[model samples]
Target chain A: MIKTKKIHKEIETLITGAGTILISSHVDPDGDSLGSQLALRRYLVSLGKKVWIVNHGSIPSKYMFLPDIDRIVRIDNFKSEDRFDLAIILECPDPGRTGDVKHLIGANMPMINIDHHPDNSGYGKIAHLDSGASAVAEMLTEYFLEVGYKIDDPAATQLYTAIITDTGRFRFSSTTRKTMEVAGRLIELGADPRYISDNIYYSFSESTMRLIGKVFSKFELFDNGKICLMALDNDMMRLNDFNSADTEGMAEYTLFGRGVIVGGLLKEMGEGSTKISLRSRNSINVGEVAHRYGGGGHNNAAGFQIDLPLKAAQEKILKDLREIVNGTV
Target chain B: MIKTKKIHKEIETLITGAGTILISSHVDPDGDSLGSQLALRRYLVSLGKKVWIVNHGSIPSKYMFLPDIDRIVRIDNFKSEDRFDLAIILECPDPGRTGDVKHLIGANMPMINIDHHPDNSGYGKIAHLDSGASAVAEMLTEYFLEVGYKIDDPAATQLYTAIITDTGRFRFSSTTRKTMEVAGRLIELGADPRYISDNIYYSFSESTMRLIGKVFSKFELFDNGKICLMALDNDMMRLNDFNSADTEGMAEYTLFGRGVIVGGLLKEMGEGSTKISLRSRNSINVGEVAHRYGGGGHNNAAGFQIDLPLKAAQEKILKDLREIVNGTV
Candidate 1:
């Protein structure tokens, strides 16, 4: 239901006609972006169409389990000699969102943009933007189904991972009956739910566990427990040798605390820079709050970077969050 | 499709004929046990049956969000004069698993035992043991559908919680297409997935967070990272004022570490007493390990209580776990 007949037909025609295709997603790719890109690349290669997956940044260690992950060429490693008749920019709102890959999209090359973000800036010859869809993988699943393409186990597993990550394991509000139905189909196609969950969520490094311990140890409540904030200092990060990937899901910790309407994680990214992640419950829009800080995301989960001391950043954010809570109340 | 004609018909007859029904489940009732009980009680009450929902142990604070949870009387508070025409025990493998409630099951009153455990003893007059089902809640869902019972929001939510907890939010091997189909139907019936996930998994008390910090701080990996063990001493528990509920998912922490084939959690219960929870990956059967120690559970997860001191208990358990790993490899 997510796919329009014309767009679906257009995609099928492009894939069939193109001798080679280039695929990519946004910078600092998450599971959905990587999984969707890998899935499409695999399907195209299976059909005997030459495919090259190029991305702006290195894939996270956690997502290395995806089949053919090594096939994804980093922008730094890409050569101009690579030939591709068509390019599929996945999950990105705009061409620039693909980072350096935007330069690869020549004026003559046909481009198809597949995305599910609500604020997608349509920027391709064929823009298949299903904002109602849970993930871009859902859009890809619909397209594959529409073309009657036989999805293999590898493709199904990657797509399933994309759906799982994007929908937060089907706990997000975007998850509908359609989402569950698609997941069911994926599982039937040989996507092991338990295997994917264990690999993605349970494979925590010792250092990562220590970092999590530090986060929980520093947890604090504010505004009569309406707001929660936890900080991971530069020293802790340096001691544990953890990166952004290691701190994934740390912001949601605040949401777990009783009476915490807003959960916030502040990471000291060094040299007066702090990365702040916010997760809100109910009508409180953390995205709007993030927008004020020159960042954007969904209503419930959002983030922004501040060029201020960690303490100052926390104070400033708390002042704004308290207002949001007070106004909403 | 999960419904069997004979079992459905029998359950329908029992419910219709019984004016007053007593419902109970195993001691230390989990979400699946409690949720299934609450759901069935709600459905029967809607049909104008007087339901006296009784349980041997107190319900966890985390599960108090269920509709009319206050209605479930604890055995400590139950009066002997209370009369019931029928007793429905849920999720328990046998009558004795219901703890002290086994004594309350009169010889004359008819009993219906609904369970999904493979080890079910079939103690009831009419035992509806669907071992293929994911949870007792799944059985209840099938029965409700078979008899054309209208599942209200409360009942649907409870059942949804039951399925989610039993199947580890559909990440366990027990999750099937039918399980997802049933869950989708429950969501359609007004079961809020996000609300339930947040409340059950995320809602941790401040003390609970401290307890988690304590657990992580003491995390240890032995046998070249094949075995993981963490401990929460009585000193830490007393200092943080944490109860049994505070340590709900602590055992799972061990399974998250990289290269961990076996995960163990040791809790100092009292003087010269320690409780051990074991979780294993793949072929490593923690249940067999627990059985050796006079405890019993499923293949991957199991537990036992030791009369020995914490250090001595850990040494013995770790030695056995190392042997299991050595033998399997």
Candidate 2:
């Protein structure tokens, strides 16, 4: 968000003058995405630079711990007089994978992709990708450190949120030795992991609870405990004022189920786009299925949005999951 | 909870020779206290020795993630055959400070008091209390390091929990450079912060959720925004079937009240003995008040138990809180 004065100069030269920076992320902004946005925004503000954290849409409610989080502007309403100097899309890949803002595909903004996803297509003017990093939040810590910015407590807090949230509190395989070092440094800078993880990851709204109950009630398991599936249609979502992001951990929770090798989420995104998220425990490949849909990720996790009806998409996912789970694919 | 075999050998010899290690703490059995106990228990078991981790009565449920958590023998249930080679109390001070287990107090076991409180009574064989240490957890890390025992992943995990939880995820004043170093060393040795914090801290149950709802619904604000209180009665708790530990942050949540100086929790512990917990935000010192009830902790955060009916305990605590908030005592 805050491209430092020197980085700003490079961006300016890249723009041939003053220009805009587009900010967007995964469909539902979790702690990592929002934390990354807030960190950059605060840094940019501190440097007296104009910056707007435009979204594909809104972030989840639990991350209200990020200071001044309410100020995030939506991508649709960002009234920019000039083209984006360097569009910075984080957490998510490119326009095709940008969910609702996928409409922004080929919108003519010079793109800068900064992400930790290994499957990135290098679809940016200047890309900085490190799949090795636990969280893009962790990446920002190194970025700030490299930029030699005197990041204080608030920046540390926001950045720490990014790392902790994205790395699943460092539970994911993405958590490497460097991740621990960065996280340790952040804690020393006053990240307060307990407060963030406690107040954000663990707590949920009553509405979220009801939605969780509804989803769990409808859970469908298969493949002799290898694959688990949960689906929610548009009607179910609307009744609870649920957005795509509120269904964040639904699929993953099933991974904790006894002997479940893979867990999958099939959410009806309405208008034929059904987003499917898949996770594996001990290497039942889901990325292959995701790649077939023009998406790819890690061996343990992958996701793709399909332009198919809810039931049809659900059937397709279940079939694929069944085959993979049974080793018959 | 696994102590190094080397430290285990040393402690076994100490126990055999010294015949007692005074097991006491500041007040409550937080992550630090329990982690230390659990890890030490595994070590003692390896040494083929029986160790007793006597608490006030019960440890809060938030920390039940440890093995043998329920096995923590309360001093009140002490049988005639129950004296130890050495009684090593980790987190409490005097016997009266031991919640419901106060009934187990006598002048029998020689004590080895290891703590970080400024007001320790020196009621032990070897008082290794350092007020500057961030936590007794941090102190134990130094102690473990001093005894020349290598902290493997599992051993490091216990120490890591002790340091992080007590320091409020490294946000509190107790966190020091050494704390981060200790964490770094632990990470280097394979201690996974995410696994421990998430497993130990984030894993909440259905009963906990229902209890949280009852808490928010029955909350109260008082002392001209200088205090917030929530009292859950037997019926409210019974209806929810929530454990006592599930309600830790309730009192501290009120510290966010802008004008509030302190916050308190007078939680009902069965029929008698109200579990009183307190937190101070800006200026008020709650430890002074807790001391009146034979409890002692930091100036900012401390707690005590009120051995009376829940309503009587609440009335007495409110009176005391008013005196502190109004500064008229």
Candidate 3:
């Protein structure tokens, strides 16, 4: 509570006299990053602050249903002449996470770095890096409530999406009572939970379901049913006309099997490479495993790309995973 | 709020002098029914009252992890000499919904019908049926708070499962701020959301995932992609070593498609009959449609069995569904 109050004070001090504001989230922005950015922008704009949302990456077609999503300018569309009194970096752990947009933040301009990553390296004039928060939007919602800002339906919808997606529909371990309380309040404020969930979860193309079927069939159980591994080979990818987004959350399927500790999905990235996504149900740290392979993420979910054939990649990755599980047990 | 208070007072008055209690939920109880029943039974026992939980059907194997599940006696195993000062029929629409246990309610035994079914027939002497509630557990949680009952970790776990399962992890339309607030309190009381969710959703056998793979293959879109119908024939059932529980909630798979308004699953019941389960997204009235086919259920979910071949049943049901969709559109 004291820390929350301190962050609120810091946010107030930073935004009090600011005029025009520039905002951007991490590259390959998810619902949490994009939704938080848009929601924060709306709140600031309502305070008569001129806000320019220049995201480093484009929004997914699936999330285009969010209100005013079209208003966010992509990095390639950002104008050099766009001036701002302040910049707000959202859901980005470090400057590099912002990709090309780091060039837009001038030395003299003050920046407020807001993030929920546990390992966030605070890199702004003011930082509200709360690792306890389920999503960056959750922190912003708290800030908004404390600062007496009214969250309209549009802002509520975006923030709600951020929380919902980040919390994996409130199933992730990070979902606290506060998370559900915020979600409930958001729903009461006209953010339809059913509508948002349908758009995010159910509106997949038939081809995506077909791909899901194919991926599901290839699932293999190992390590006394503690690990489940599935691969989308080059042939299947070609057959499905696979896009990067198609395989999103596919690895999490492994954790669905009873007693499965780790679930891994290795997607053929072509050119003798495979992108490995891992999801865990318990204390098994897939993030550390991913870090060893030049990748990092949350304890429960992580990913890395291996420059090896699918079979070879699976073998090496499974060996490392087995060792990790064995050590932990 | 007033209604909630009234029900609270009535419950206090009813349970004040009551000693031994008999409790039972509806037949084929899902997580909501079983969880709610178990939580209530725990609370009652904590008050130094003797409690016997007799359900029409046995508890599902997946829910065996719930504390004291072994205490619940199946209706078939219920002894005739058992007597109770009060009876609590949970999650049952009417007396008939209790299946074979209807005979257990003697003329002098006062009953409390706790339910959330929209079409619940108020039959109990003291009906605490709040259709607005997401589940009976949600209502019971409020009652426990109102009456000053200490919710233990085991009880919290049970109640939490009840809410999560009923609300579809807070995605359903009935979920409110109050629901989330209650959920938050339950978690704070030691209801591990991750543990409960994994058990309820992800602890399915490998055969279940294989069945899901098969279901995905059988999806057929019709009514201009607004309706999706999937089926498991007698052959498929036999091949998979079918159980009555295997096809449970399988019809809900249709609601996952992009434009699907109604999703139906047809299961071959053998002996020239097919059972149909219907799930709807948004405002499609599946219950009313099921009523036309001599079945009854909620507005969004309903089921009925047809005395016809699988192909004939599918054709007939599809035609009826197409007309309903056309009329609605």
Candidate 4:
């Protein structure tokens, strides 16, 4: 466990003393969490420390253009004896989020938590957490600024990615002046916004496009046009070659129509199980409803998985959304 | 002919004086040319004037989304009694440019030349022209500001269309500080940048996706690695249900590799002629070469049509490009 002191001081000591620190994030990570984690790693390296970063999961092929991605450990290819003096975690709010790396980190190194998620429970010995921020990368960005580290390209890109994903590319309510400030800094640091945006939010793989076509072709608008949903059965997902990660931003499509206040994606993950992501563009608390389903997130966007048949889960979720939207329960 | 005296005043005077003004461009109009033409028409209407604009030939379907497209005139629609006080030409550098609507401009009216090509020969009586400007729309933007009319959503959208198309969404060398200033003004005028950008650049029809897939499958890089070409024969076009406008920006795909100095799209436009669009990202003067081949455009991007077999045209063009890149005669 990390030593008790100020989180900023402890992190600095660990990173400086370790000579080499390994930074990591949970599996199937997104821009915000991953960007926060990677930005920290790059910042430390810039200070002359050897930094090792590993993603417990595969990098989204869309983000393959990022710098230092090649250095991020994936297969490890090392004996368990190899050790890191410190492990810094960013964004992921839970200790169980170590994914496959938990087994790897169990025997060696003290872990530190640097997150900005309300759900975080001060899980590590050194927790630098703030839930008020829109993204954990913002916290790290503040840290970097405090330490007099300039916002460089790698740092900017990751920070930009973090902001974009957390703020739904600046369309969500959490987007604030600070969000714009971070984005502007990134742009000044030579982040190709159109390149980043087109790849991240516009362009898609052939299979992903096919899956989107299939899903939208069957989209249903309900509750007097206030709710919109696209459902994908297991068979359709398999046929279209859609990965679980591909559904990452699928909930966003429902917000296109004029009156789709509540939008969601319901995808069958396995037998008697479905994954649901909810998005509310305006005037709805999908988060409260998701909370009822054992999920919690911001008032506008949240998600949960269901261990029930597609139809049954769909019915229950709709009822919960109705209650929340109508202020009945 | 539009007298230079008439050009010295405000925009309203031009709209008022030109009772039945005609606007037209060369065949295969792009977003910049079309956006400027259409936006001027829409703005004139806001001033309570009735105006007529005709495209001498056909405006490719890619530009159909422009504001006043339906009002565009064609050769077949010309009337024997058709007369105008002024004819405003945009981007079209020369009269009788292929299917250009020279027939629609009665001999009695003076034409105003609004263009951004160096080859323009002071074609009209009242010319508001700057070849150094990236797009004709940039000129119209200045006109809009001088007219003292408050910029609105449609105006912003139109201006954005002009800037985006001209700059390759701000990546081309033509993107200047002036372009940025104009864009900033439009954004301040209530232009939803993201909304317009997503619509124009991101939203593609299903047919476009299919066509893109086919194009990728058939794309070819030249032996020298300095040239890339995609040729869509009429047969492939028909099979893919593609429109000529869908081929509008296809040539840009080739500027990707390490040394790809020139990229082109040569399409068999039916009958005996093949249409060609040439793009050189840096240094090469494709426009001068286009003029030599009976076409003219900017220094870096230009187009021409050849009445020859597809293979013959491709070979001739490639030979020329190889010579140009090698600085050989």
Ten-residue stretch with the least lDDT total in model 2 chain B: B18-27
Better of 1 and 2 by TM-score: 1
The true-structure Cα RMSD of candidate 4 reads 8.6
Number of the top-ranking candidate, with DockQ as the measure: 3
* Poorly placed runs, candidate 2 (over 4 Å): A1-23, A41-52, A59-72, A99-111, A167-180, A187-329, B1-28, B40-56, B59-88, B95-111, B122-126, B132-134, B167-181, B187-231, B236-289, B295-329
Candidate 3 backbone collisions, by pair:
none
Q: What is the interface RMSD of candidate 3, in Å?
A: 1.1
What are the lDDT figures for the candidates, one per model? 0.85, 0.67, 0.85, 0.69
Worst 10 residues of 1 chain B by lDDT: B241-250
> Which regions of candidate 1 are displaced past 4 Å?
A2-6, B1-3
- In CAPRI terms, model 1 is classed as medium
Positional deviation of residue B115's Cα in model 2 after best superposition, in angstroms: 1.1
> For residues A122-164, could you state the per-residue lDDT of candidate 1 as single tens digits?
8888999888888999888878888888888999999999999
Query: DockQ score of candidate 1?
Result: 0.72
Q: How large is the interface RMSD of candidate 1?
A: 1.1
Rate residue A99 of model 1 by lDDT. Answer: 88
Top TM-score model: 3
Q: Estimate each model's TM-score.
A: 0.96, 0.68, 0.96, 0.62
TM-score (chain B) of candidate 1: 0.95
Cα miss at A149, model 3 (Å)? 1.6
Error of 1 at B105 (Å): 1.2
lDDT of 1 by residue, B189-257 (tens): 989888888888878888788677767766889988899999888898788876765576678889887
lDDT per residue, candidate 3, B1-329, as tens digits?
89879888997788777898888877777788888989998888888888988888666666888877888888898875857899999988888877888788888899998899987889877898888888889999999998889999999999988888788778778888889899989988889878887887788678777777777866889977899998888887887777756557566677778888888999998868998999887788889988897776778778888899899999999988998888887
What are the DockQ scores of the candidates, in order?
A: 0.72, 0.13, 0.78, 0.06
DockQ of 4: 0.06
